[model samples]
Target: MKPGLLALVCVAFLATLPPVDAFAAPAPSLPEAGYAPLKMTIGGETRCLTADGDETKSWQYVALKACEDGSRLQNWKLKSIGNARYFIFNEYFGEKRYLRTYSKASSIALDSDTSGYSTMRSWEVSNGALNDIRLWNVYSRDIGQWKTLDADPQSQSVGISIPGGTRVDVWQYGIDMPTPQFPVAGTRKILVMATHFSDETSADSAPVRDTVLGVFGTPYYEDRSARNYLMQASGERLTPNMDFLDEVDIGERPDACNASQILSAARDAARHREKNPQDYDYLFVSIRQWRQCPWVGLASVPGNWVLAQGSSAHKFWTWTHEFGHALGFHHARILYGCPPRDGVAQLGGDCTTYNYGKAPTDPMGGGGASMFPVAYQHFAGWLSDADVPWIKHDGTYKLDPLWRRGSAAQGYRIRRSDGSVLFVEFRRPSQPFETWWGASPYVSGVTVYVVNYAPKARSMTSTLVNTTPGSGRSMGDAPLLPNHSLDDTLSGMRLTVTLAHNDGAELKVEKLPK
Candidate 1:
């Protein structure tokens, strides 16, 4: 090729090569960026950094106090001050006033005294030991001290300190979430198998398969029993694949009808089949007779066994309720301890089993007639953000019945600044379960509950906010009706149902002044 042509080609190729950093966007500086607020909990209490005493005080000592939702005093604004440092400002106060530590030993205080940004008023946030979050003091510019927001053990008040191993629980206050567990996507297939001993005739085994298929496979569960309605409302769909392995000759033994024996036989039979055993997600075993058992089913994690009997043959809610366990449902007992009712003595102590045969509105609590509570629905991944809206500010909202499919919100979650939450929903008596159980006037209405997420203990407590003072069975299922308002004076929130209907309801919520 000619020298001029070669030179031209090389020049064109060079022009085509992109310049350095062509696709890169400039990173924003921290000082110019904003941050979300943080809720800090220590010593099992939610604490807010406060400018204690008169608001007009120039240098009021910053102290810890009980966290209150929507309280400007409890809301701390974290502002970036460049180079991994942050200035914590109390929203209760206006501009420039920031939390500052006067000396290493002095109590933390709020001051507008600084003419310019001070590193002594800045802090560094980082992960600490045992999953705890730590904040470091950037005052000396040496990163020397573990500055912590501490709370008094007795009064649960907050202050600044060089913390020891004590970990501070830090999280955003209003982030709503579902219960954490293994999730089942799409529709799940459940296998129902009926077993017969060597001595038993095919005639005796007929009831087992007949009842299993009739109850689970047909509309008995889906429409008539209200099981599928409950699950589908939560975004879980289950299809019962009834496989009647009638009169499988398990060698004679008195314990053959036991739960373990039945599970083993069913597993063996499934493995021996041409189809792979793992194809089935659940195993339901049925026997001929009953020996005065609880007339319930047993679930061993992913595997579930239903001991169906003639007495409770048509009461299929028992089986459906047990399968709820396999799907990762905890008993819908009164999550928090409930006080005495009608001189019957208080039941449900710290979630311990006390009130069985109560709570007819929840299947987990011997109430086969009622649907699962919003708490269980949230935990079971049934209520998505679309269904349950988290209310960050005060507003009037419309809600549909939790079971009905609609574009409207089924529930509203009002999160207190302290990380507690209020869940409001509408409940009614319409399903077959409710009709069969004779809808309790107390349960068929609107409901409100308070959920306390205890970080230190790694547990959640759900307390029902009663509608009729003490009319509910155990944890109380009755919801407040239209034109009725219930107030949580502590959280400064009032929920009033303006209109109630078979399909939905409208709620007017007011964040009352403390």
Candidate 2:
């Protein structure tokens, strides 16, 4: 070989295996000044905290590496509230240096070096931090104006998407409410319920009486622990089982329509199927706030149920509709985030479209005996072909295969006393993307593609997606590993997966995701 050619070969080989530092970045330097122990009471505790570096910014907790060995203080951002009022810290999941032993809404604080633990405040954190240390801006640019909550009233509150770090519990509903605050006025996302109530076998007659705790927010749903409530209208006993639609005890479901009897059944629905936040599909339970109108019944999350005073029967729609919101769905058929067009109409708060199944006839759409109305369609299930465009365009549900493959899927089923509702979710691994907009669009749980995706590999973590850079995310369905959704349940509806492998191989799935 020519001498120059051999030299080039050596250079190429060396380039492929650069110095160890090639993959390493500089460690954040500590401030010249010595640090001290600091302490702040959060919720109501005097924990101890230590910091090694001088605070980079005041009233703003920028990157604060806890004063522990191998901590990622400056690495993780921190917002310092005045006089260290709220040492808002941002720690990702599994970053041992940024470990959290408590839930965000519970009692907790950051360990400061100066005095002790910092004061307890609702410092936000994400499940999968992605090490995205970017700080949260002042205003929250949620999807619709319905999130406005009149602005100023909500200005002082933290604008967030991820539910990690810390959160202020403004309400007192039962277990499995939003697990966080309800924006301003104790209401987050507003929803409108337009449905036809069931009549013959199922009907929730008594209007759900609500005891709103105004400044205290709404009481949690889990606060009530009855096995199930009888639906006074439908005469069905709502069961507790938010795990999956299948666990609904289909065998014992009693079908009937009555006033007091259905009201009693409603109890079963509310208590059933609420999962803890640790579950993968935990995000699916967030409920906004609702209003009551004569012709409309409203529902919101966390645990504040509202019903129009005119007709208790109308509340059935609100029951199901609000439950839909808890799982991240707006009105069916309505064009949202996207501009309105033909077939779509702006209903005071949420948008609506006229393209759904015979909503007046479907039980879920608020249809049944004792009462009669249009039915709702099977619109809130796994992502459908028609829903993919919007899911990818708006990021409601992600198509990133990285998260799909990295984390396991978690499923849940929700129920109210009036009747039970079935659902499935692909939850974020551990703590999901907790950054402002970094969260995958799977807000209302996730719309997993049950068909048409197969990838074979030696288990690798490629740069599948990174949207925080303000770049449009890659467009492609997150690989649906085998038949997760299909095998998990049994229904008459047949599922077909036209899977395509990453290695230029076509595949088909007759199974489900494990």
Candidate 3:
């Protein structure tokens, strides 16, 4: 055939094929450029991908090393090349070198060339199991070999290999992570911005403003208000000073229940009123409930913003619970259907499932107008080392009510054999706020929780232990009454409540037989 005829035939065949981008995966949402650490757990220990040197070296091998704070070698930045593909750049030498796999070697190394070898430097990223990520080299796809970035625990080396055999290393990246903001002993200024759609302006905004003021400004509801709840919960360690911005009409209805759009409009309205939203520690946006909005209240986990709709803005539990999220508290969940005697089994049993927002002893669990639990308080840095002493040996501990003022051992901590922690606290109904406990069985008793301090296990951080497994009662009746005991067979610990009174309770912690 003639050359012109052959070229024309190829063009016709190419036109019939799909576009090159048609097979590309959807791009993930990531920042244009930020410092991130690729983390993976290997051999029951957390490790991070490191550049394997103190300085920039050509062909420096990449390996999995123990994660360290302020380790520039482990810090990486992803440069997007579109289509969910990125060039991994190391931040140790100011991002001068990027990651590349050698054709003859089974390991990945740092390379400085960007003018050529596009496929060698490009990587396709996707979401993996439970907040992890999977990275596949684009060069492997060109060679018709599907391989993912894998780490070898024996060699501590990283390479591209087929997944799902004996290798189980899944990488999770933390990009521009925020510093944990614990509600310490200080006043946090809050800016409350009330907004409504143009169609919903006929309703009175005064009630909303009054509700905000009552919840955060004055003690309108006495101890039930958010201000009072925080003050008592933190033992006056944290307080709120709120400034209310006049209600603004957003001019149009939102297309859906988009929190970002609503929050942006609220912030813009605050700026119009000469109030900078950044001046306050928290930005609280209140809006009327709409049909599209599914949540009554929403908040950024460990962030400085919260949003409330309609009656949820007025409800005490909603206000405190959402703000509690802003203060870095996960949902106070309960473990159900697990063994009552073994705390470790209760935490890790495959048959057991968790119920969120069910721990009726704390506000984070949607318990009506109650203070934060002792575990949460300790996490927030509100509890001192003396307040929650670690019980290493068998002894009788005199515990005070968590809500009371005096510092007489408000809570006790026990280290389990599996590296998890057990937090034990005594609870009694405080006036005005904890009135919901009056009708519940947990009004005054000893409560225990199993806390896992792993970073990836955020959802199961603090779980309320069900003391009475077959009682057929709600989690509200989970606490141990007077003269009752809890045996943790996995931890070899037995906790017995020897005495109970209005002032406090006495718990005898003993080591059980192996």
Candidate 4:
């Protein structure tokens, strides 16, 4: 055979074989510098990333919308600027605007500038499971940590979130998904596990076990336990069953507070005893005091796990507060520093200061192990719709003590003009719990709270209206006493506590002329 014919035969054989790079590692499916829909699958439905309102406008809201083909607002342009960072822009508006995140608001919006490093415009894109991708703002990274870009399928909104647990969903680029649903109701099983470090020989398992059982198992209504507090707070909607796992030694020296490692060990120990941790709805881990940990108690927001360090696990306020977080509740906040008209601090005025866990009558506010505020109870779906009616007309309504089950109104919901809600409830000193140090004027009065309904918000969503502002009074005295009135200029409504007694209180809701 001729030499040229033999060479041609070799070339033909090489063409018949697969490409070399195909056998090598497949290139990452992450978005390159191109146009595509940033999609996420939530609740079995596909939602496409979309910019709300005018595309050319700056600071337009960004969210996930129903997937649609050929929709300009749904299409995003990924422009790489090296180092896995990208400047994302809406294809409808081109490069004039880019996706930006506001850390304070935990929101994503469109911006015009592209010069800042990671302040807003720059986003770091990394590969997730399979075709999924995770986005983090460089500014958040510079601030020591970054939250995940999470989506609420029910609300059709997207925001930055730090999940309460190890599990989280990463956005899937170029993939389509559907919408989703709600959480479980009624009885939820709770598992309590105690752990101690190898160096802590003084850590006793007996008292710790008793404390755990007392906090969750005690059935007496007068007992200051999470079970009793939640039962009253939930109006019997939620009944949590408590299960105790024998204490385990994690065999680790507490050099630093590593929650993940501690929780993993506790879960493994439960499995070793033929108990599956996943069988319970909530997991509570109690650990001995370690100086290395900066926090006494910690819990995942809207998550199922809670960690309590030291003797705090035994305290009613500490463990109950952590459990509140697991139930999807944020801290009860007090709004301060507002100009006072008459006697009340005008909440509609320029109130800038906010103090968390300052409302002294509610457990979520770091108060005694009392029932949660009316707003939180309402959020938990514990309040009946008939009991908490929306105030539409000016009228006097009787509000029973928030902790008691009664025929009178438990709370009132007033919708402000800006779409936010104002919840009004009466509080009185109850037995075992709701008994703070100063119980005279603070614990027994009509309390009002402005609740912003943002399901994905990480900050304090409820702000207590300070009835007695600039009086050098603490947050404990924030509730409106009998015969006192509050004029909320923002809501165009005036609330006056007409009468008060041991049974309940009378509130007058009058609408101001617009």
Prediction 3 TM-score vs. true: 0.63
Question: Which residue window of length 10 is worst by lDDT in model 2?
Answer: 452-461
Off by over 4 Å in 1: 1-182, 199-212, 215-242, 254-258, 273-276, 290-295, 301-314, 334-354, 416-422, 429-444, 449-465, 470-477, 489-491
Ranking by lDDT: 3, 4, 1, 2
- The candidate that wins on TM-score is 3
Local accuracy of candidate 1 as per-residue lDDT tens digits, 84-126: 2467776667556877765553456778777433656776554
lDDT digits (tens) for residues 72-157 of candidate 3: 88988877665445788988865577787656324567877565457778776654333466777767665656578888777767
- State how far residue 351 of model 3 sits from its true place (Å): 7.3
Model 2, CA-based lDDT: 0.22
Please, what are the lDDT tens digits per residue for candidate 4 over residues 313-414? 777567677776655556666775566776656666576546453566566665656667777665555654566777767889998877676878888877
Q: Rate the local accuracy (lDDT) of all candidates.
A: 0.50, 0.22, 0.65, 0.64
How many times do residue backbones clash in model 3? 0
Best by lDDT: 3
In terms of lDDT, which candidate is stronger, 3 or 4? 3
- Candidate number that wins on TM-score, 1 or 2: 1
Our model 1 lands, by Cα RMSD against the true structure, at 19.0
Question: Where is model 2 more than 4 Å wrong at Cα?
Answer: 1-121, 125-294, 300-303, 309-317, 323-514
lDDT of 2 by residue, 1-514 (tens): 0111011001000012111212111222211222222222234532223223434422222221123433433223333232111123323211112212122222222333323222123132111111111222211211111111111122223222322334322211111110011111111222112112232132232222221111124233221111111111111212222222111111122343221232223334334444222332211111112122112333222122222323432333434443333222222221122122231211112222232222221222222111110011112212121222211011112222211322221222222121112222332222211111224332212322211000010010001111111112221222223231222122112122232222111122222233
